[model samples]
Target chain A: MTTSPTERNGWSGDGALTDMAASVPKAARKTSRLAGPASTAEQWPEFEAVAQPQLQGAAVRRLAGRRSNNGVGSSNSSSSANIGNNPSKRRWPRVVLIVAAALVVVALLLVAFAACSISRGESSFEGLMANAVIETGANAVSYDEGKTVYYNGHTYVLNEDMVSVLVIGIDRKESAAEDKPVQADAVIVVALDKKTGQATAISIPRDSMVEIGRYADGGYAGVETAQLCLSYGYGDGYETSCEYTTTAVSRTLYNMPINYYFTMDQAGIGPMNDAIGGVTLTPLQTIPKTQIVEGQETTLLGTDAYNYLRWRDKTVLTSSLDRQDRQIQYVKAFAKKTLGAAKSDPGLALSLYNQVSSYSITNMGMDEFSYLASVVMGGNITGLDVISLPGEMVQGEKYAEFYLDKTAVYETILDVYYTQVD
Target chain B: MTSEQPPTTSNPDPKVPVVRKYRRTIAALTVLLVVLLLSASGGIGWLIWEHNQREKAAQELAETPIPTVEQPVASTPDTPEVALPDNPIDFASIQQTSPDVYAWIYIPGTPINYPVVQHPNDDFFYIDHNPERNYAFEGSIFTEMANSLDFSDPITVIYGHNMHDETMFSTLHYFEDADFFAENDEMIIYTPGHILTYRIISAYQYDNRHILNSYDFSNPEVLADYQEYVRNPDSLLVNTRDVPLTSTDKIVQLSTCMTVQNWNRYLVNGVLIDDHLTN
Candidate 1:
């Protein structure tokens, strides 16, 4: 009561002002006219000059509007009218902009993370009937996503989801340059059904006479009937070579689409053998150039793996046919070991892929490979059926040629790549 | 129970200083924001600059002048074989660039035409170092200390980086293709007085274990086993020729790293096919 009117309202008074405000040349007094007991009109002019630099345009204007209406001290009516123009009015837009910017940053990070997770230089192969299905016949019945046909009294549908990989064993020796065309010594088409967890491998002998596209000077010349293995020699020796072999095989097997190709040269046998921690098998035949006795169980390791897969008596014309039988046996054992190892250590397949990548070429992406590996690792696959093409080997000109049984090829393709509609 | 009421929303102290109260905190926050922004930008900028510099250096090194082979004089049935002229590569001039240059290797159908250098002191000095003795990720083609300079070793393992730009030994992958491996076979190494030609027998991926360190080449049994492995590598990705390899044959192995597996190496195995004297 003893203090002046200016001092009572905390203007130019040390007792009323905080230490922070007292430190400034001219302090900004925060006044809520509606909430406070009373703030005089005389105090506002000084407040405007000192706080104008810090206050937003809207806040400053609101304060200025209040000063004009204020005439009497403790004017409740004037303060009540200005309450709608509080600091929160300006804060809404700023909070919205901040939230929008935060969301944009989060979206960008998510996109970048997804991009990084995808494997580089790997592409998923699109199946031929990925979207469109072939018309079977008037007696066609649709089953799920597949088209069905009445085949020999059984309603069969093309299992479009079956993942087929063509496995080729090349027969080019280290000293193999003089040979005119490289041969696919052992050719096997491995197909797996993810839904049923069933796997089937069909081994086609190298000498099977099939239609092969001919190329001279890297350009397609014409299609000629040649031994099935010679199809691999027409391309650039990597992807193109693999493609030619796949196409030849597809044509040979009722034109069923093959999703992938895996080729192993004679060199990859030993490391691949050790990768599965050595495959133990009783030799079906006495393998030449090695001490492996027929009907004796031997754990093939290092160079022994090479000899077991590659040994053939060149003098015998049907030596290749004999060799194919041995290869089929080896493959069955190898697959069993690989699937078993993968079950215990899920990373075994990818690690093996990486190890053999130098010695092998594959079109499989990491995602597709992992998915296939996971299916195998899930312990869902209990049995693998390997079938050799029913054919007769006849010595043709200089090499042995195997003429495939057409009816058998047709039925095998249906059995391996098709599902029962019922 | 004794209770105290919370402060009401109305009548907040009107005398409180708004701007002066948070000035120190505001200044500190602004400084932290600026520092974070600058360092993030600086790190990204440095990475981009380094990548650009590496590319530029690779381009400059690839333009180095290399010697081309002189076509041999045609031989009639009466003559033994085509008579090759004197060595075209000036060993004297190449030695001037670096005395460590002992031989130049050229593979037909591949860009692997470069001088082979062996550091007198450090075995890996040329692995990440260019021929000009500058730091380069695309290092010069080199051989280790275990082999002889005369190309007389039973097995010589030459090493190079599989550069992303497909320089150095990257083109060696062309042999992985069955067709390319069949069509192309010869790899020539030209020393000061001798032109040694090797017939490529096999090209495939092998484990990363040091070949020289793992095996004793002097042992005939080991050489036989190795030759057999080379002839019949169990890898699915192999290209082999019909040429035969024996303990009497000298072989050269061109080695490079695989893209995915650091623990594996791609090897192009070759056996000595011919040796011609050059002035």
Candidate 2:
């Protein structure tokens, strides 16, 4: 095929041809490859399909080839085929980029999955397991009964896992000498059941006759059966005093072991009560007004509370046992308040612990304090059974004394300290 | 047959499979690197968190007020007073928190100062429970309910886990060394009204036995015979100090798991040399 000279010259002239050539530059027209044939109009669509990216360059070269005045439609059609199927086409780069992005997304998903699986549960504190409870009795006997109990003889025998705490409020007006036994004003034993959160608080009257190991001038003078409260007077310091008091209480209570003891003086008692923001008292009976009112809902500050605790108005409620009832009520309320306060601010227990350091003494460690605080906060405190040894008030050589109802006290302790489970 | 000499500057044509192999190798390396990087970061982060938690607990314990439970009086009647922890806490309040608090056991040289509680009827519960009364792998130091709470028994055995972290009875192993037993021999047991002191006399490895359950300590003859056995123990027993073992001297045994056998336990025996009533 060939193009007529007139036709080729006219299409390739400096003057624009028909409509398409008008936009073409003079240099482009001279170099145009499409100029090889007058049939370019018929093949224009095919060339445009593959030459879009190098449109201007390919168009100029195509036109220039035909500008030689030769007709070649077959050649132009074949050129478009090769360019369309070329592997180096810009399309390959887009495919490569897509593959890289997909790889990155998959890696990120793997990382996320690993992270989710590796994260630990919020409640999982492995250290707590070492410092706390060991789940036992599950594989041992009495699976139906809780771990803290053993079913024996139709009654759940509490493992003498019994934690008996003796609480003492000392009546020493001045610093006691090493050998002087200062009597405790109030003595109470709070026994807790390890299995069930039952607490039995038994208060011993001051005048009950029980053998207390006497400490004389830095030496123990064997056992002397004296007023129960006089046990505190056997030792000059806190240790001896507390020990004798504890021993006396133990002896009076059927020799039940007292696990730990706490002694507080008037100063410590008041501050400790106030530390928990004062305890509210509601008197059940009418009495004379003093630092704390008798019948109304009166809040006692530390000092006022202390005065109320030790107040033994001989005229009204002549027995010291009457003072015990008041002490029991005050202790319960104070414990509740302290626990509630500690729940909000655990530091409160520590602060109170420090406050009582100088004037008070106890065998309890902070580990014990923290555990008690948690138990109180957890509301496990149940069976706040408060009782005193059933006794008769009698006259002594100098002061009035109370004779403990021994059989009754024994029965009460057995009931309060142990419960039957079938 | 189809090929003429290729360009000298170029090498052989890479097959489709070969190109694919190179791409796979690069991806695998990238994946491995990412995993390693993540593991290093996560592991280091966890370690820091754990250390911080332990530090906080140690600080709190150090500051926990130590009551003047141990009297300042020296060992002898006329000896000078020594500095002692004097802060006392209300045990009733503590029992409120943890009913497990049965007694406070303290040994001066080791981390044995802790609240001891008997497992409810189960001598083995402390093998799993912590001081918080929670099931833990490193259990708390505990005693069986068979023992008298007043320390009146001829033989009372306390148990703890042999944790590698040197917690609980793990430190009790120090008694196996004769010098450790001699230098730090005193073991103080505190109750509501008493400060009882014991001197470490013997330590050795022993097998598991329901000790108090196995024998009756109530009989005077049985109690006397057992004291003889403890005084003249097996060849493995290391006797650090010799004090006359009488029927009256109550002995407290500290036991922990031993590595020699699963059923083997290391025991430290202390004789009640002094039973003083400290208020």
Regions of candidate 2 where Cα sits further than 4 Å from its true position: A1-156, A174-181, A284-291, A314-317, A382-384, B1-279
Looking at every candidate separately, what fraction of the true A–B Cα contacts under 8 Å does it contain? 0.00, 0.00
**Model 1 chain A: worst 10 consecutive residues (lDDT sum):** A15-24
RMSD of each: 26.8, 33.5
**Candidate 1 lDDT by residue in tens digits, B1-279:** 111222123324433433232244334534644554465455556556656766775565467555566767778899987686779678899788778889989888776788899987776677667776777656678887778898899889898776545568767777766677888898999998888999999997654435665456788987887888788774424668877777799989998755432224578989988888877
Candidate 1 residue A3 C-alpha distance from true site, Å? 99
lDDT of 2 by residue, A148-187 (tens): 2222334434344356778888766743544444678788
TM-score of chain A of each: 0.68, 0.58
In candidate 1, position A344 carries an lDDT of 63
Question: What is the C-alpha DockQ of each candidate?
Answer: 0.01, 0.02
